[model samples]
Target: MLSDLPIRKIIHVDMDAFYASVAQLDNPELKGKAIAVGGCETRGVISAASYEARKFGVKSAMSGNLAIKLCPELIFVKTNFERYKEISKRIRKIFLDYTDLVEPLSLDEAYLDVTKNKKGNPSASLIAQEIRERIFNEVGLTASAGISINKFIAKVASDYNKPNGQKTVNPEEVLSFLEHLDIRKFYGVGKVTAEKMYQKGIFTGLDLKSKSLDFLETHFGKSGRYYYHVVRGIHTSEVKPNRIRKSLAAERTFSENLSSEVFMLEKLNHIAEEVSKRLSKSKVAGKTITLKIKYSDFSLQTRSKTLPYYINDKDLIFKTAQDLLYQEQLNNSVRLLGISLSNLNTETKKTPEKESVSVQLKFGF
Candidate 1:
């Protein structure tokens, strides 16, 4: 029955502690030391942590103060987005040598469909290894990879190994592998969802499989159907090469919270200008404008207005954001403000699905 399903060779390549590793690579003094890519001792959040930092419970999205409490020796480095983008371009060049069917998830990772690669290699495992090696040798960075019959499995498998390793889940091993997988390891399942699943006695993929479709749907809503299929080795998401940009945004976290909307106009104008620059760079415009406000207490609020037509001008964006700012009274002192444009003009027409073909379980590696 598994052999009857369509199969595609997919590889998910993830750079190992990308931001932190890049810092180490550029500065010899940071090598093998506990380091974070962003944040500071008093304010902000850690963007990425090194393996050394991870050993001490330091992690991304953690408050800098908390991270310091976890690892007192943690070294915080400034983020260099331009440098990261430069390295990412080099890595992407290597991927293109293997296949044009590359879908980049971020500057640090991407999904590549190598079923019919330019290398003429039937072994997806070998392709993944070569890609990782190339990334290390050419970009001065280590990467990990997961190779499987589908994107979902490939993404999950990629994390099984870390720093500089690879894992391949052959078509035949998909069921056994997923069955034993921890419920929390499912890519889309977050802490909240996992806890909910645990309450329902679904701790592993096998347990999840035991629940009837109706039972799962009754409990999990739309996600229930997704969980039902993935465990059975049945994910059909294609690797889309040119993923569209959904939104453009710019935001700032103030060092001091402002109590009045009058003081936010300058900040809003600057943010709008930044958003406009990004929109122009992406060559896209949007109909929806959103204002995001984060209070001093960390509470968040959003106000949105969908225009009659798309816009990308700074003045227009600032005016919309200005209108939104006064639309509601101040809930609390605002610490952060952002402007985003969505419902983009770049939205693509849906393409017809390609015909699925039967694939035999013959992994060359």
Candidate 2:
């Protein structure tokens, strides 16, 4: 009997070295050169690195000192987390323009479902290109995209081409793609799991497919069943929204309402990082950035910006808060700072149209 699961139109969009790319976009001097965002100081980590820096073995989460060691000339800068968040919001808003079914994988990557789309155009590949172009034109950054029949295939395909390229894996080609794939490349099969699979003679998708369901389940737990289907180019997960509140923030009450540049930057970055991690985990994106500050004697002021895009980058996020931080001068100094992001929406599949709401994804082949 044929399964009830219908094919889908899924596109995975990933910005090319998002943080570093944004920095490069803003500074012509950094163009085509290796750049890293985060503090240039010893304790800071590399927030993002350009392809050029990546070529030299620099990567995000690597220590700032080690990154500079890898590339003596690598440029290190403080992270503008607020700025990143604002820009991320703007970028995501673009996705919502196409479809409400966007599942953000990270600040720089997301899966869009265009299965039932608003755009009259039926080609997801074209839509991906249009989104990429729109991002470049509006945000001054470049992104790569991948289109496929499901999120599993689309996310993997997005990485096939990097730095402003787009690729698509149609349904007919999925089985073939899985057949030749290395076991290590299978989603959720990391080094340890791959080694375990190797011990079980599962070096490729073919080997995995050969394993009986009971045997796989017995050995690998619930994940084994997942792997079994993946080996066959099948996945049943849908783009679900309204998951849960990822985060709630608290503001510090200080001795006095404060106006301090160093204090505000410190507070905003911490909050943005906290919010970003939660959003990343929930696979969600937000379009609103809110800032809260209280004056010396207890006068409170709140500011927010609804970006035209969605984002999760800490630097961008922090910068936006920083902008809010300075937009109004504190009449009194010393007490309370808060940052929050609400109006959350998961960006999924999208098609190109100004007022398009949802995408209708259909597999061809």
**Candidate models: Cα lDDT each:** 0.91, 0.77
Q: Among these predicted structures, which one has the highest TM-score?
A: 1
Query: Which 10-residue span in candidate 1 carries the lowest summed lDDT?
Result: 349-358
* Steric overlap count per candidate: 0, 63
lDDT of 1 by residue, 125-187 (tens): 999998888888888999999999999999999999997999999888899999999999999
> TM-score of predicted model 1?
0.95
How far residue 119's Cα lies from its native spot in candidate 1, in Å, is 1.3
Candidate 1 wrong stretches, greater than 4 Å? 349-357
| Candidate 2 lDDT | 0.77
Total clashes in model 2, counting residue pairs 3 or more apart in sequence or in different chains: 63
